[model samples]
Target: MNRFPLGVWLFALALAAVTALPYVAGALNAPSATLYSGAALVPSGAAVDYNSHLAKMWQGRRGEWDYQLLFTHEAHPGLPLVQGFYTLLGALSPFDLALTYHLARFVLTIGMVLALWVFASHFFETPSARWICLLLSTISAGWSWLLLFVPGATAQVGPIEFWLIDAYNLIGALFMPHFAAAVILQIAAFLTFEAWVRSAGAAWRGLLLLTALLAAMGIVQPYIILLSLPLLLILLGYYVISAKLLTWRRALWLLLPLAAHTALIVYQYVAINNDAVWRSFSEQNITASPDLLYYILGYLPFIIPILIGARTFVVDEADDRWWLPLLWVLLVAMLLYAPFPTQRRYLLGVQTPLAVLAAYGWTRAFLPRISAGRRPLLTGVYVTLTALAPALLIFANINAFAHPQMPATTAVYYSADELIGYEWLRGQANPDDLVLTTFGWDGQGSGGRMVAALGQRVFMGHWIETTRFEEKIAQIASFYNPVVPDEWRLMFLQNNGARYVWYDDSARVLGGWNPADAPFLEQVFSSGSVTIYRVRLNG
Candidate 1:
């Protein structure tokens, strides 16, 4: 039932290839030297978030099932699912960690592409409709390309991010594998539940399938539960109020899966909120929905069409299939503006359903009214408007990250000396030893977060993962200030559990408190301008 024609398979592969272009270019252009720092280069785009995953995988490679916030020094119990699928990938895969990352991304990208096609196949009967839906769902971006002409637009994400890019499938698939995995599972759960709903009222096997899919999604990508559970509730509501088809047995089919999945969701919620470190991470995990204009422009190609066909299943066809995706689109649309920290996350896989409705609308409602000569012009315009925006976004990303002839040292890129500094500390420092390095946004000081990925702790690293990120930044700044007394600096290091201070050029840029000035700091390793000094605990 999930299989599609050969053309569809090839189309999926092609889309996956599009997602891979930036990474391939980044790798070919990556800089090399006699010695390198860390196990991986900062990924071309989204380096900070990418490094956070590296920290998780590094911990997982060490055989820890629970993941700690390696970017921060705060002691807290590790969360099970927080290690995420990447951690599992690192633990099981024998290849180099960097290679493991790209390999998994490629495979997951393929999976996401195919999964989306299967979902489209279930909705659209005609090949033409299915293909149109595929194009819009996969590559379509907001009309943000127009914004590329605005002054200073080049400085930011420019056209691609006029709305949040993460809302779209192309960006979601290319993001961390977990995001891809989430999309794949979401589509899978969506398909499975629909199948169960259409089956015999008392089909126990269908309930089991629905239960397992929900439980799995809940465990791996729990934030999605925020979207999925409410969807299931509304679907059941439709069966009861709109159709009057749900008998007690049919109710059991939906209720059982809901109950089982709700338990997992509640457990996950309690677990995350209970831990102090993770609580901080959760509080900082804010993605409030953008203004109405961003989304309107972002999804402009499909919005009117989806509205044009919102009643497609009700008027043109009689079946349970359309309600599932239609309601999914509605639920996500309404909730995107709901009061919540993770409001924008409801967008995962939403465009697929919207695309499906848009295609249906075009074929059923809009195309029939248009003249034959005008239809071709409108179709071309629609296709171009949808595809060009995201294409430009991809090109912008590649231009910024992959075109550089030589890799420059930045917050993301490690210098030879910085790499040497990290390698020395890796061998010398014990597990959980907190290393002090000031965090900076980009360029020289930015690479400090990687110190955590190499298996040491950082006093502060990730802006989000580190507890009280601003407070820690202030503390580090004051510690390095020239006015701070040596006596206070010595006590500060010991108080915060800093066993070693990685005083590099970046750190020097912060203040004039040289390692030499602090007699309590015993210089143990030095490479170029980077030096590692052990805090004298007893002196």
Candidate 2:
């Protein structure tokens, strides 16, 4: 019999299709005013980051690396691997950035499915168990539907709120490059390391492959390496203890990847300056460190199964195979609350191991106890019960496509004409030119993120970009505040290095000061309510 049954592949495909339906529908009927609004098909928190990445890739295609001048100080410094990956895609479709975005999404979706399957296969021996694990991995819930009405139930216990099955990984894989690529590479690394562990000391090939995988992960997402290294070490320690012999050569092989990872981390933090790397750490600082209760509730499904099968996993030498997943869950739980700004990121790539453990629990402890004749019926009922949360999650996500939430201003929130104006600016402006526009809210014409992303130029202000954020906001207020003297505004523009000013209905609403009032400013492009003004420094 094939180790991975055909049923597992079929189920994986089905799950992928189910999850992708909403995005496909949104793409076919994209929202008005935005190109590739298909990204909004799922309500992802990282939409802005992903959109910014696409813009950077587009800018890189045009021979410019520093894409988001407003967010980071230098060009193409952070997420080089992610930027390069999409840059290649953008080059393939030189004429259309939107097409490139969708193509990247497609690649991410396929890649995630394959990675999940490969990772799960390493832990599961039975096809049925693997299928169960795959399906469960795709769904999440904060509350159990069965206990919805009970007082202080899962829903009522706000303190215990957590993703029963996190759909973010699935949603992000389709839209977010940093998330999708890092997750894919993380799984590959885990698989490679597991192969080496199983090979004992003899498989030099596995060690080399593991080293390469860790290095690649470091380039894409160094934090993943940071979170993964301790767990790998624990696994290595387990092997050393179980063998009862001092295998110095094997110990060196295991330490090689960790050493490489440590070097990458040092270089990324110490060697690279002017990178505006802090944006990644600071922007999402508020939600970076979730509490321990949140994680306990989030992985309850797997936790219950692990607890039930703890003895089987501990005492039996045959149960050594189960140690990796258990260790992974424990390590992830500890790291989620670790004293780090990106603690929440450790949650990524965790579900696969959790799913495997849950499946093991179901087959070994739960299913066998039932009578043989009733097993199929009971299994179907159990599967349906397990799927309820994810099924609802999928439905809710699909519903969000029609009534999408307003994301951060940096996302694909601009109207088509506004985008056209930004495209025009990209062609006409120099690489170093800075544009002044409104700072907050995506309300009609107010947000100036378009210039920063599409035009590859600096803007006056952004919420996430901390460099001179307060100073720039004050300058922008003074320039746009109608009560301010025109002379003061002109001096402000000159002092701040702003060469272009974009005026749309948003700029008008925020600050009624019009560029036309200033003789030094010349109108360069106008379409409908939107107009671009060039600051003639000499005039």
Clashes of each: 4, 6
**Model 1 agreement with the true structure over 1-539: per-residue lDDT tens digits:** 24777887787677777767766655555566432222222233366566677777787889987888877777898877664677788798898776677778778877887787888789878777777777777877667556556786446444434335467887766656777777788888878776666666578877788888888787667777777888877777777677776765567657778888888878768988998888998898888876666677777888878777657645775766677777788788888888889888788778878888888887777877899879768876887778776676566555645544444423334567777777787788886888887775442353345543485678876777778887877888888899988888888888888888888776887887788778899999988888889998884
Model 1 score (lDDT): 0.73
Shift of residue 333 alpha carbon in model 1, Å: 2.3
TM-score, one value per model: 0.90, 0.82
Regions of model 2 farther than 4 Å from truth: 1-5, 31-34, 41-44, 63-95, 140-168, 200-204, 244-246, 271-286, 373-414, 441-455, 460-475
RMSD of each: 3.2, 4.5
Model 2, span 270-357: residue lDDT tens: 5334344454424433435444555565557667766777666556556556667778777877877777766766776777677777
Off by over 4 Å in 1: 34-45, 148-163, 310-318, 370-381, 402-411, 441-453
